[model samples]
Target: MKKESKNIKKNKIVDQFEFDEFQKWKIEKEKERIKTHVPTIYGYARVSTEEQHLEPQIKQLKNSGAKKIYQEKWTGTTTKRPIFEKLISLLLSGDTLMVTKLDRFARNTQEALTTVEDLNKRGIKINILNMGYFDDSPNGKLMFTMFSAFAQFEHDLIVSRTQEGKAYAKKYDPHYKDGRPKKFTEEQVELAWELRKQGNTYKMINRKTGISIKTLQRRFNELKLKDSE
Candidate 1:
């Protein structure tokens, strides 16, 4: 009778061990399932100037199921983005980084390529709303590289064209100033001068011509100096 009790106790212990192993396997499989199906999606939106609105990009990202978003009103040429850096640090290997467009991701080729490569190495995927998804796959890499190159080329071409146009203008046009166009035109300045000569107060001239009193006074003084010379 004691021998029979020992055999039953041994079987019970074995059964408990098997049960624990099965529970551990079940927990691991559950974790794997969640990891496969529920990747976190992060969105980024950016504009070059404060005047540009982030609403459109934000809305698009929301519609595309981004769980969180980072936004900025910063020039893309600059390398420092504190919020962006924070967001990048939080991203995990299975996460996806989504952006409204390539320009929003990066303004130049080198920045884009380097960022993408780093993310790819860490098993992070990128989703550009206008360009579709990109991963570490051979085809995805090729396409992303080509797109980045084109983006840089386009920006450079635009800058080169603008410089050429400015150079041509400077050579051909005697009155062309090499900076921002004047807010008030030469005709407007002439009108202000005429008003000043008629003994109008700077305040009165400002009300009449929409030019600021300071500007009118400065111009009138300059013109007086030129006449005396």
Candidate 2:
């Protein structure tokens, strides 16, 4: 009789427990937690020079649901970007880093490969809008490798073309001068030289003519060499 009473009490509790309702509550709570804990999405935009604008890239990233965005104006050949560094430091596991394209971030294959590998190791995701998710799979890795090689090739070709054009100009153009135009004219140099000859120091000349010491030194060397010749 005592055992029968114990079984009745257990059945009563089981019948009232509502297992389906309990499971639904547990699942809903889990979904809420995941939603709250999702990683932040960040976007990065860069332009090599002031001539290139970043507004379009910024708009696209914003449309992609990026919470924070970083803007940088720097050449891709250099790795010392302050804004890029700051963005890298802020990234955490599960966070995604988005860029408009790959070339905006890296100039060569080695840099591209190394940087992607590093981000992979840190559990950070990279999204290239032009391509897809960088393709971390075996086939994806092969694709990235090929893409890197092509990017490097294109950069090398550009450099070669620029150099070839410059060389041709130098050979054919009688009045071709190298590099940028001189900031100081012949008259300015002569005035600076006269000031120097009259005991005015480089500092004094710089103050009066706004020409740098290095420029003065170069002009003086050219004049001295011409005299000797």
Candidate 3:
């Protein structure tokens, strides 16, 4: 009975030692993971119009471990987005640019492909959360190219449909005007002309009349035709 009790105690001590060793090993593995897997993720969020929601996108980025985030209240069609420009300026090699979806990055395929190619050239990476794609490999590049082409096709189709609708409306409606109406009334234009004749600066006229400097200048040019007499 004494021998059996002694053996059981020895086994318990051995088991405890193994458990302590395992805990130490797990701690070291976790430290290694923290050191080696630190990703420099940059999040980008875009809204097509002022009325759209940005909270969901921001939350998703935060949940995804994004280290930095950029946002813009602009359409995806234009490549001149302020946040996008700022992101490009800050990007370094091995950094990842993350977006919620492909459409959030660009509306047109050419722009999307061109932007991706430029980033790849600079050794920057791209990640689209919805598409399950990353642009750090050749296969990923090819997939992105295909996806961009599809997005471009979708954008073109939407534009074409909008143009068709506008054309139909113009053909059927007699009061349809294709472009923007004049911003100023005849009285405003006349006042702008008089201000210019008095040698008033464009800024001065703009401040006094609540007219934009560009509008004041345009009106001044139009009134010059009458003044030539």
Candidate 4:
């Protein structure tokens, strides 16, 4: 009986050691899998024009832990964004595409929906900082569709109001100009033209008057046409 007891005790110890080793091996395998298949988060930032700054969007994206960021100064209304296309082409399954806002990602509703659906099909996710994460779930699709439509509506409303205001101004305000206010005064333009008449090249006039060569040439030609009339 004493010999049998000893054998049982030995067997128990061996079984315990084997169980512990298997657990350790399982943990190591899980770590290896995670290392091999970790997902990447990519950020995209955009502005409508050159005058707009991208620093704010970049700062937010970095704070949100984006590994790579793509940016452009192109308008969101068009779907032919070169940088955006390159970024999209690089995205793979199990990646996240992040943007600061819906409008920053896409201005057109149909374009936004189609792009998001394609990403969803590929198992990629979208994280709009102001909104939240979106995925392939039904709720996610509904919420994204609603927000995209609302954004487009807001844009169209603003454009409609601007057109109406412009028409009213043209009718009532004789001093109103059709587009952006002139950066330079008539006096400044006339003086620049005088420098040109004194045998100063456009480059020389630009250096002296702080006007760009293109602006100088365009203004000078306009002045010449007015004088001829």
- Across 141-179, the per-residue lDDT of candidate 3 in tens digits comes to 788888888877887899899899889989999988786
Predicted structure 1: lDDT: 0.88
Worst 10 residues of 3 by lDDT: 30-39
Q: Which stretches of candidate 1 lie over 4 Å from their true place?
A: 1-38, 182-229
Q: What's model 1's TM-score?
A: 0.62
Off by over 4 Å in 2: 1-37, 180-229
| Model 2 agreement with the true structure over 18-43: per-residue lDDT tens digits | 78679889889867765676698899
lDDT of 1 by residue, 1-229 (tens): 9999999999999999999999999989867865776668999998888889999999999999899999988887687888888888767788999998898888777788888889989888999999999887899889998998888888899989999999999999999988766679879999889987888988889999999888787777888899899
| Residue 92 CA displacement from its true place in model 2, Å | 1.3
Q: Model 3 reaches what TM-score against the true structure? A: 0.56
lDDT of 4 by residue, 1-229 (tens): 9999999999999999999999999989867765686689999999998899999999999999899999999975565789888988777778899999999888778888899998989888999999999887899889999999999999999999999999999999999989888899999999999888899998888999999998888888899899999
Residue pairs that clash (backbone atoms under 3 angstroms), model 1 = none
Look at candidate 4 and tell me the lDDT of residue 68: 94
**Scored by CA lDDT, what does every candidate get?**
0.88, 0.86, 0.82, 0.90
lDDT of the structure predicted as candidate 4: 0.90
Poorly placed runs, candidate 4 (over 4 Å): 1-38
TM-score of each: 0.62, 0.62, 0.56, 0.81
